[model samples]
Target: MKIPERYQPKNNKSFASYWQPTKDNLLPFLLPKTNISDSEKLVPYYFKVDDLADEVAVEYFTNTPFNQAIAKLHTDFSLFPSNKNRLSLATQNLFQQLNEVPSWVDFDLVNLGTSYCNRTGTAALSVLRNYCLMGGYESSAINKPLIFTQALHKGAVKRLADTVDFWMYVTEINGLKPNNKGIYAVLTTRLIHAYSRIQIEKKSEWKSELWGRPINLWDMLATNLGFSIAFIDGLSKLKFKPTAKELEAVLHLWKYVGYLMGIPLHLLPNTGEEAAKQLFLWSKSQKGIDTDSKQLAWALYDEPLRVTFTKNKIMKWFVQKTNLGYNEVLLGTESRQELALPYSKAKYWILFLNKINEYFDTKAKSNPDYYNKIAKQGRKAQEKVWKLYQQAK
Candidate 1:
């Protein structure tokens, strides 16, 4: 990686300034079941990783206690390598890039994305786990790092907890600003990914030519798309309609988050059309599911059963099946089969529940009190979900 145009900011204006989900521009948010017609391609991004982090991680991990330091850095971003080290000037450069705000950032839009997350509450969580994260497993090439890191053995609850925490932090209003928890989360995650890439590349089993880097730029951008477009699409399935402006703001929010996380922002998508095309090509890179795929997917598939949110045996069963149904509905039949997730009658029942909620949501959204009440309900449910996972044995 030659570090192409490092700190290359996205050139698009704010969501409200230029783009709207008009008929000509309103490409459906759904991930298409067939191949998309697009000139852009995904193969090249596979050759890229976070060059700045890659350099810092290599020097730091090679010099320090690898596992212990990686663990400590989760709570302390200051442990990241600095300018004093003689090997390279990556840290001084990295901080400079982080501090320089891109011309495109709009804090109001960022906060809108956060508001959307909080308003939908547990539905956002469900959509993320079932649609975005679980759906990610079908592309077997991406799971190498998780397997290498013993993610399945450590359990899905642990993995999901970390993921959930990161989402919660970054979506908070003004969370991505310097010295904030959101910034801290991105810093910790970026280095952790870099650490994994280093460790995985050293293994005899990893074929760099076939899979690209362990967590290449392609995969990293795809993860960002998962949070941005895929997340919005998943919420749509639940009949939660965000305005055109709101939709674009969600993508805009993740664009900045991706920036802070050291993803090569030049390749990050700012609109629905761009995101759809990028994701379609990236998904094309998958070969098929294997044992490791099933092992990893199973971790999340059974996670609801382990959550200690409710002592009522019947309610727990309902929650478990609803989770399975959610996977079935959002992931489509093919992905459910690929993941080997069990069938549940609750899939249709779940759809019916959404229809009823949508009716109320449509009416309530016009009134501030009603919408705030819905958001409160959503926040409460999200808290329960997070607490149960935290308390899970």
Candidate 2:
């Protein structure tokens, strides 16, 4: 079939249209109006997007009256310069414990050997990416009290609840229901689980740096970004209906991850060691890495980047976990439980989605009828989740 001229992609819209434009499309259109010829020079044209920030409450949340109250709480309390200064001081004191090696070994070089430190850096990158993706304003107006609250909140449930509240506010503002309980709940749960894993891993490895101390940075930053990437990519495939805001949030989060890893944000189709080169840039950007360390990490992490990772790898991993989860009743595993499901309706519908994608992969088949059937089911589920979320507010 010959493609219609209007329908054919003339520029980057080809890709943007494929994904369906959310807010990012606004900037590109506004560019020509600003009279900027150079795309790189057009970054400043985005001032309008950045200038429009305001703090608005959802006015309807029953469980949490304030929209993004938890995130706000975290920003206000824990992440302030005072708090960070203290954290840096602690880190500095912690740094002092490492045995004094010859100038050849170097003090800052110790973090490279510390898996824990690397992981913390990655986790910090993940959270930073998440906020950036959500367009968290880099504002002096950001409440320091909230920052402290988020960091100091010890219970995983409380922290997760805060994140849910932020998501809820986002959904309400965009006129979408918080549909897809299973995906959201599971994503949060797994992140916390990853956190626990980091802590345990760090505890086991904690050694004296020069005296052979185990490193603890893994629990700090890298764990969240690394683990969550796999989870988000999987969820994106199985998702039946995600609001534009939600989708934007996810994409932005991924872009930020790429940036911190030293990957250029424009890398398309998101695959291969070529992709990992960006992340390796992040790791090596730390002063003093010899050529050998950089090469080894890249070589080790490469298998996860192959195209097969998207097909068999993500599908296989996510499907197995979905089956093992509370929503597995939708998969015809356990009988549907009576407990109030967070995203009960979408949970069941998402299964059909999994199946359709699987058929396309394992059989190399495209069944339009089947895709339509799954999409219809998803629409119904989305309606249910959306209403439920709004009603709760």
Candidate 3:
């Protein structure tokens, strides 16, 4: 098999390391069963971009109406751009995909997933920020796109604020439905990624031969899995028990979301085991944490103090300590030190937090009414923080 220039690994050593099989993946049930040769076969996927969206990006610059057609999707997805903008076949094809609902999607299950996420509340955010997003910094190449775009200029706090808004929109009830902002956001993000690829390629520093297309399908799948399977891993460590159905729904929900974002449905995981397999395969070529990873980690770590949700110094200080406590427990000392996270005895806070969460979580599970109440409360708390994010400078 010929290794394409686009598929080349930034670190030759990591590329070699990737070909060797590792039994470790994630979770007790979701661990991947790998054959030693698995990584060798899938090496090219790392360089693959969303061709449809990339075409849209190419045509989008030449055809401004295509942009308008895309924005129209926020209000009504049915208005296919084919007739309106003389869109290229690629753009029209993307519009059609967005309009058609995949047969596998179960709205009830998707909502159930949303409710589960809602019920978990701040704990869910904790895993997403500290573990999934923060811990994801371990990748040297996958994060290069962010660094190339000067993401640090906006700072991690604003970036986190933007991310929260996007997550809330996508997880909102019936949010992914046609004509909803959730669908719109996903589509827009797809285009943004494509556009970013174009912009970054023009820069001299971007090494397409080593890093592949920006936000490639491989990278997108990695991120989507972070939200689904890896997210569950973090939540599990928090001692939050999600029912089997909740687990299934979360995977299904993210699968559809990933599909809309132009990730291949085949590549998206149908189950946790499938997710772990995909995760393990893609992770083979990734390099360990570098300067970019450390910078991003520290930014996220300090975000609690910068966010405007609470101006009270004492409360903000306590929240930072709590987050550190979370990082200490979830990320372990080795990872913590690599990212230069400050030391904290506050890691013990997990005991108290888990004890309280477990008690209430248990009560809610046994009583439907109580579960509904907490779901409502959880969503409210999230919205309040979202509002604060919006107000921040």
TM-score per candidate = 0.83, 0.25, 0.88
Model 1's lDDT to the true fold?
A: 0.72
CA lDDT, every model vs. true structure: 0.72, 0.27, 0.75
Show the lowest summed lDDT stretch of 10 residues, model 3.
16-25
Query: How many clashing pairs per prediction, in order?
Result: 0, 46, 0
**lDDT by residue for model 1 (262-320), tens:** 78777787777777666655554355566788888888887766665566877778877
Q: Pick the candidate with the highest lDDT.
A: 3
- In terms of TM-score, how similar is model 3 to the real structure? 0.88
Please, what are the lDDT tens digits per residue for candidate 3 over residues 197-217?
Answer: 878889998876666667877
Q: What is the lDDT of residue 377 in candidate 2?
A: 46
Candidate 1 lDDT at 171 equals 78
lDDT of 3: 0.75
- As for TM-score, the candidate ahead, 1 or 2, is 1
Better of 1 and 3 by lDDT: 3
